[model samples]
Target: MQYPRKSYRIYFILLLIISCTGERSTNSKNNDSAAHNRTRYFYETVKATEDTREKIIYLDSALASIKNSRDTLLPLLLDYKIFYHNSLKEYDTSFFYVDSLISLSGAHRDTANLAKAFYRKARIYNYLGEQEEVFSNSFESRRYYLAAGDSSQAGRRTLEMALAQISGGDYLGSQETATEALSLLEQEKDSVYFSSVHNIIAQVYHERELYNDAVPEYRNALRFAPSLSDSLSILNNLALVYRDNKDFDKAIATWDEILGKADSKTKILRYEDNRAFTRWLKDSTQDVETELLDVLRLRQELDEEIGLQASYSHLLKYYLDKNEALSRKYSEELLKLTRKHKNAGMELTALQNLIPISPLPQTRSYFQRYIHLSDSLQMASINAKNFFAKIRFDEERKQEEIISLEAENRIQDLEAQRMRTRTLIGSLIALLLLLALSFLIYYLRQRFKREKIREVHKTESRISKVIHDELANDIFNVMSSLEAVAPAPVVDQLEKIYLRTRDISRENSDIETGENYITYLKAALTNITPRDSRLIISGETKVNWSRLQEEKKIVIYRVLQELLVNMKKHSGAKLVAVSFAENNKFVEINYSDNGRGLNWKRARKGSGLQNVENRLSSLNGKIEFESREGKGFRVKILIPS
Candidate 1:
């Protein structure tokens, strides 16, 4: 019965569009100035009017006035038409005007107008729940916004994109987009938009059930809120997050603050209901049922469908364990309201809630409806994600094509320049010859240095093997022979020497290649892992080991071996998990362990860690460490494939 409520994403988008008038300006010639003024007056009148019918009449008058004017003002007129039709919920008419606006703006290369047109199209598609169209138009809008040098508009479009991504269930992508938008808005120093971005980020985290991460983001939103109403809305969101996180005291306190400031009767009732629910969570002895019923009466009196739906949902959940008849009654009411609103998400929840409390004869029908709705919702979500992915792929492909065309043009230009330079080639032959001789000398010196380094490594490997095979075995034999009579200190010293020699041997060992490389790597880790600890490996089988070069493999093997050795020596770890994944360009390895983590101040000075860094540097790779004392340790390594 814990329904995932829909956010006020559309409200924010609408607020942004209405409040941002700076982006609307006429760049038409003096000949059209009179028409432009008349159009602007009519548009302003439409915006100022509260009555939808009057707004429509003003929009029509503006469109009529501009019909005979030059095409310079056509884009603005089409925008008005689209906005009017959208407000009237005449989506098909809105879509037609959007198409007309895009066509007109594209013909004139009016990037700013085109951006607005695409943004309007995205908003229309969002209302229609056509998420694929929403994302496609949003991307186009963002591109045109950037082309128009409107970074603020582009940042807002990015927030819209993030919302589309969230609706498609791409939380990771949404979070990344939200972060990018947040960075842009911070640079712009626009407090209102910054708060909106923070709210989007918080919603992403909240949807992902990362309540701890969501809390600070909602607080940040509240800190930046421009108006008292906006602040109260953010406070309510924060309270909801706190309640979900089981911080009942904070949730109740936030609701109290909201109730004190909220002037609208519906808002006051909603906050009171929220407070009652939180108190019930803190202590079940509270009269949550009576409080919810009172709120329901007020919502019913106000004809607040959304608020009524919420009250019914809460009452249904409250009665679920106590009275099946009352549960069914409230569930039916919730379903009716959700159906009236055509809220598929809440309808799905209502169906789920009803299935359990339904009568035995009707249970099968309810189950069937739930399954059908769930599958349809899932498919819709999948289609939205696929459409967005396809749009991105197409965009990237077009960019690559443009780059290829530009590269060809550059090559042609360079070829023509080469022909012109042919006449001067003979004069530079002597200079070129001198430069080639210098390059040869440098290459020889570098090759000689590399050969010397190779010889040194070979010598070390030979000495290490000799110590490991001959000296280490002899020492172990001596220690075993004297075990009964040897003092404890002497035995300890011998054991330390044996371990050091073994480590040296491992450090100098050649990397295993061919088909057995992964097996060899696993064996190396197993040797160092403690018997009481667990080591889990995943995704190793997914990588194509043959694609990796010998040098990279050697570096990776050495680094992982060093980490395991360090863990075994110093960390009292109970569990370690390592996962490997590869994309087209990079092989990523994630390593984590439950252990006494590194002291960050001293971790950089460790010789073993330094060696790891050196090996990674040689392969042009990178390693990132995340750990705190008494917490778990984690390392992420990325190397070119």
Candidate 2:
């Protein structure tokens, strides 16, 4: 049995709907599974420790797990890989990961992830000592963080930026950045970041030897420190600042506090070394040499090069008078360590320590080296200060310019708004005026149309009366009078009178429309053409006359009749041509006659031609007349379909 056609269509539609639903369900399940896997891998890697190798293993495994998924999580994983490689100091591998993270995050418009990625890149660059790259990437990260509305992250990055500036010897710039970071973090009330910012500021002042400025900043850092360990670290730095300022009492007290709180042997050794130095400064006769040597041995065992440098410097200072060999050995060791660490400030200090202790020639050589290094360092510091001053000046100028631009823009906006308001008002007024003019024109047009109709009615009535009462009666009377002995001229005159009366009646009658309207129009034209005239008609059959409205056809019929009549009565020539054609929107009619051409100016003043123009105007049509002395007359008419 065959199914009905409607049933077949319904069955086919049901099959398509089920197929589409099944396909969508399968895709949704796949997407969900992929999302779950990505989330699982990300969590697994994030929970891993900071061991670079271990982090790399986890990240590699996670990447393998989601190798086919190109989602937001992919960039996040790549960012973690960059951080791990950077921690391992594998710079080339780290940069590769950085590039990958940037590409993926940028492509996905993951602003938060991109910000974190740039921040990691900045940290790596900082470690590589690429000062420009560090500054640029940090700025980029801060901008992206702000754009992502992660203000807390942006504040933290600002602190990192301050630290970077400090490392680059831009102490003033560092101080400014630290203050900015402080302002941002204060709004957030982030105690940890606040502590960090204060610490950085204090370090900057301390480096500049502004111990008075540094003391308050360190106190602030201590007050805001979030953890015991962080507080201890700040206290240690505070103690060092006191020692540098020669406040031996405060320095010893701070070190005692650090020693009491410090849990590890390394911390105890560090504070001990610092306290020993402060004691030696206070009284050179104190037994600080053994304590310094003990600190040096401990630092060497721990392989802490930085701590060893500090220990060696203190030991050399202590042994300067008592043991020349040990003093020189410690100085050499300090210089070597400072150079290895690329600490120019410490190297300068070490050179100064060595110069006075060496023999005549060696002392002279050391003194010269010291002077050269000092001058270079001084010049660098001066340049850094100048650079920071220029930066501040430019920033201030930019702020002023921005303020000026904002004022100008506000004025422009107001002016534009006023112009818009004026334009709108002008447009409304113009529109109202146009409507009033249109109403007046329409009123006049309707009034004129009514008057024309009334005139046509009156003419029709008068013509009908004349035909019935006067012309018909005269024709009959003449016919009766010459019935038996009628001359040919009298008989012809009577027949002419009858035909003229009939033609007048037809001209004034209502139009025949529809299928037979074209035939009526053709007959009217043929009747008006004189028998002697050579009528050449073209394009008449080509026109779609059936599409034309009845009123339009009547107007065309009247205009053509008027033209033909005028041609026969005034012009004695024979040839007359008429053509009709149509376009998409209009029908065009061309009529010409070889006749005594009209006086162009006088013809425009004639009432009969004006009536023809009025009739065409009522139908929204136009007519053009071409005539010159001794040339054929031509008329072109266009009527909307």
> Cα deviation in Å at residue 350, candidate 1?
2.6
Collision count for each candidate, in order:
0, 0
Residue 611 lDDT, candidate 1, scale 0-100: 79
RMSD of 2: 17.0
Residues 177-202 of candidate 1: C-alpha lDDT, one tens digit per residue: 78878765544467788788889889
Q: lDDT of each prediction vs. the true structure?
A: 0.80, 0.79
TM-score of each: 0.57, 0.60
Q: Once superposed on the true structure, which residue ranges of model 2 sit more than 4 Å away at CA? A: 1-70, 186-189, 321-323, 379-427, 446-641
Which residue runs of candidate 1 sit more than 4 Å off their true CA positions?
1-71, 186-189, 423-641
TM-score of 1: 0.57
Candidate 2 colliding pairs, count: 0
Q: Which ten residues in a row have the lowest lDDT in candidate 1?
A: 1-10
Q: Measured by C-alpha RMSD in angstroms, how accurate is candidate 1?
A: 38.5
Could you tell me which residue pairs clash in candidate 2? none
RMSD of each predicted structure: 38.5, 17.0
